[model samples]
Target: MSIGVEEAYETAGMILFHNFDIRAVTLGVNLKDLIHPEAEKMCAAVEERLTRLGTRLVRQAQAVSGELGVPIINKRISITPAAWLIEPCPSPQAPLLLAQAINRAALAADVDFVGGFGALMHKASTQADRRLLESLPEALSRTQRLCAFANLASTSAGMNMDAVNQVARLLKEMAAASPDALACAKFVAFANAPEDNPFMAGAFHGPGEADACLNVGISGPGVVRAVVDKYPDCDLTMLSEIIRRTVFKITRAGEMVGRKLASLLGVSFGVVDISLAPTTAIGDSVGMILHGMGLERPGAPGTTAALALLIDAVKRGGAFASGNVGGLSGTFIPVSEDTAMIEAVECGALSLEKLEAMTAVCSVGLDMFAVPGDTPAHALAGIIADELAIGMVNNKTTGVRVIPAPGRQPGDCVDFGGLLGKAPVMRVSRFSGSNFVGRGGRMPAPIGALRN
Candidate 1:
């Protein structure tokens, strides 16, 4: 499958001018075998395995990027969920020790982030799960490269309100423990979290996955926005077609790079996550793409409908381009990571409620946004529950990566710098959801979960 001259030229143009890049090439390394009864021994084993694999991942990704002329912006690692590994450890602080080991491995390998430092408590929490939850604030705050996620809900098992409530409190503690709540940016709460998602904070080497595999995340919000801008007068249907074609090209490029990289590394090729992930850079925003579709701005009237169209079109195109399309293969609307979304929040065009609404149609949920420090933990749980409920009923993946920025109020800004970007503290409802959130038990799965 060689690239044609015309296709090659177009791809070059998109790369040169439209901020198109391979956002991440995450090597999912299963560390379930590294679990040992002794915490020290287990930590050494985990570090060794990750360092060996992560080094290969970065080298292969760099080689592939240089050969293809596409920028592979991040080389990351995702290991088996920490809960599984921590269950065998004797020490109370085993989770933190493991997190430190993971961070050391990432730094040694020169990877950007290493994920899977949390648990899956959708149905019930085990003793190890509890310990991992308890250790999250300290572990995340202390580690730079370690990212964490907890699957608090799923369509089959239902929402774990107890786990959700616990995480809410931990999130506040995590913010207070760190400067600017930076650790909160490394954590995410998910419903139906995917096993092979290459994107950070939620990615993990699921128990079902192979020992080692490579997954690629391709991002091109700027490219999509450019195409939409080129056809300004087109109808909605025409606009969708244009976006679909553009995404097809992008996904094909991703598939080529992923296959080549995996081959070079002697690992199985997993999937190409064709998510239009945006950055803080100008013209590289999903919100700007929405604005280009004539919504006046993101969070304006008809924004959800426009986003739904874009999401569906991108998925369709990506699926056609590669059968390996998986993960959250849709538009990402992270508030802080996208310049246009940040601007919208700053100017009051985008509200927390509206962003929640957009998440119902987009890939992830309530991502990278901040709220007032004094906002109750139960309120954060309420927000997470609402977002996950959408995924539960719709049978799709949804997540929350919001931060309760310390000492920040509505209209205030917290700067995270670099790709984490800056966020304006958005206002939450003054009303309380404590009584509702206090009713801690499993929220039953939707009727759709009975499909099997």
Candidate 2:
């Protein structure tokens, strides 16, 4: 099916229209204020600040969107950790109470998702952190818009085998909670979590972040795929170079849009996350590009090699364009949101096993994917634990945001709606890991962790 010159030119035009992105710029805000003894006052303060902030986020995002033409996907807010907030409150019930407060404030702000609600126990989970972490089941189950994250490990601190053990158990409990526990999709366990990265559920307003700085998220998988499609016969080296040049240009556009948006919003400018994000739209897929690159299957054989090359090239290129290149800079392969990845599952080209394997070399782990509804909670915990282990050992940032669509069987199409997109229920192994995941203890930080 060789494309004629005219069709190639026309397709190129379409790709450029959608794919030429300086993706998105996001702002992370700290909300240590939300835990005051005067909960009412604290909540009111957050709501007011968020309202004022939303005006800036929306106005600036729209301005940037108008100028860039490539859609800035979301205008989100990430707050200072709920764990820290809960720690000072001195009550196990504090997390749930504060979560409700934050949830309301987020809604009032006209934002999409609000992040940072769990713990950071890379080595130790304080009594407060554990209480907050344990409360996630209730919080996510109770709130529709709040996103949660637990930083279980980091490159400098090594892995928190203990927290991993708890997270595994938490998933099992959450799954049993029925409809709400599935909200775990809003939760992520991160390794090497960055303070300024704008995406969620990992994005958190670190202590270093200003009260309200505007961070940016930039994605252009469609753009990169178009460039690759243009040179179908080119070798790996040539392909890499082309992608580098294109990403450099795209990131420059991102920096320009981000700075302008932040200035208009009257906030300090933050880092640009140069991740190869995707959408449900066709032609904006990393897996599809890999398929187009003659891989035959996206998660088989030379898949990791291709992914390693792709991620490295994207970083090398994006870093060149922006001195502020800082968010989740690696590529993402969240299943449902990525049309090509969903197709691969339908066609039997990608499996959960292979997807986790691919995560070993790339950014995040199995995300927004669907597995058999019959997938036991223990199995789900196992699923998340395994992926986090890869991040733990490899010393990278990896996470799992899997969806077990209630009662959906393998190959069944489940629509999560909105930005979550649709997913074909992927087959999960029938085996059990209950005994292993049930072992609740910490995985000590690896020995190589000297830098923080």
Candidate 3:
């Protein structure tokens, strides 16, 4: 985490001119030790622990941000998946109760978000998981700060079509319960989900991690794009080298900030997630980076090739910069959060089909996009199944955060404001894959999974 003088100067320039910032400093806290047989007792224990730790995390993250002159956008907390803690409770309300407690603690502590209201159901689910899944509509629609995720597929365990089906049905219910379908924005479905992701709504303290750790998610799409803009006339290979170098510096700066914050909080420092997450600010966009790489816009022909090159260079640079790089450390194309992406959809340059093709090369899939409200539950299931299959077969982490904007039509828009940003409603195919995804069975692991 040592920052040389030269690197410091470069990072200062990045911060001052290019919107380089730490997107989130998420403190992952293991809650396995706090589980209790009674729902009230368990909820009480979680509330007490999270309130104290979350307060400290928010305070220290602010201090570190000011002390280093770097912006830390969101102070967040990730806990052990809530379903495991409620396994002993017989009450059907256990999940909702726990979610309320966590939400209260997050509000008390003044953190931006609290993630891990989720379960690992890549293959199958327990009774507790089923109970939690059923309560998602209530929990997500009711809580402002609590985020939820379900790992429905993985390379080794294959795809959990049953859980996928359940989540798709729950999503529609969640949309019905919340305005603008905002509840769906807080819930993501994943395949090969990362254990230590610092980004929501998919972050959780994996069962294998330490009791507490601090993970940092870095953002520098603007900085990288600025660098890419300078190499317009250069060939793709050289452009990649330059982008790689810029990300190397960005990752190093993020590691320095993360390690200092972790030390201040008296927790172990986890990985630096070098994902180029974008925002609505001008020039702060992964899609703009692609445009700078010579695409007319994202979703144009050759856009996938440009994205593939960009992400590969990003990974190589981050891996070179630090040994502790983890999470989904690649490019994020969340349509709502990136202005260029939103424009691409508005101009009809980006379609759902093209976005799907791009996801095969990017970090996550179908993030923060919107579709018409009348999209059938089975159609949503078909969409999730398609993305999850990409991750399952490719052995990469992919997720979906789609909003079925209730009563909205294609070409309409929904504004969630702040970092959730605005999204244009994209058209969904009228053709249904109901019979295909309705087959409730596991899609078997790939031949690559049999390597072990």
Give me the candidate number with maximum lDDT.
3
Order of candidates by lDDT, top first? 3, 1, 2
**C-alpha lDDT score of every prediction, in listed order:** 0.92, 0.76, 0.93
Per-structure clash totals for the candidates: 0, 12, 0
Model 1: lDDT equals 0.92
Give the residue spans of candidate 1 off by over 4 A. 1-7
Report the Cα lDDT for residue 408, model 2.
Answer: 76
Give the per-residue lDDT of model 1 (tens digit) for 1-452: 99799877778878898899999999999987878999989999999999998999888888899998889999999989999998977799799889999999999999999999889999989999989988988998999999999999999999999999999999999999999999999999999999999999888999889999999999999999999988888999999899999999889989999999999989999999998899988899998898899988898989999999999999988999999999888678999999989989999999999998998887688899999999999999999999999888888899999889999999799999999999999999999989998999999888789987
Q: TM-score: which candidate is best? A: 1
How far does residue 177 in candidate 1 sit from its true spot (Å)? Answer: 0.6
The deviation in Å at residue 417 for candidate 1 is 0.7
Estimate TM-scores for all models: 0.98, 0.89, 0.98
Cα lDDT tens digits for candidate 2, 204-248: 888777877888887788878877878989899988898898788
Using lDDT as the measure, name the better of candidate 2 and candidate 3: 3
The superposed Cα distance between candidate 3 and the true structure at residue 202, in angstroms, equals: 0.6
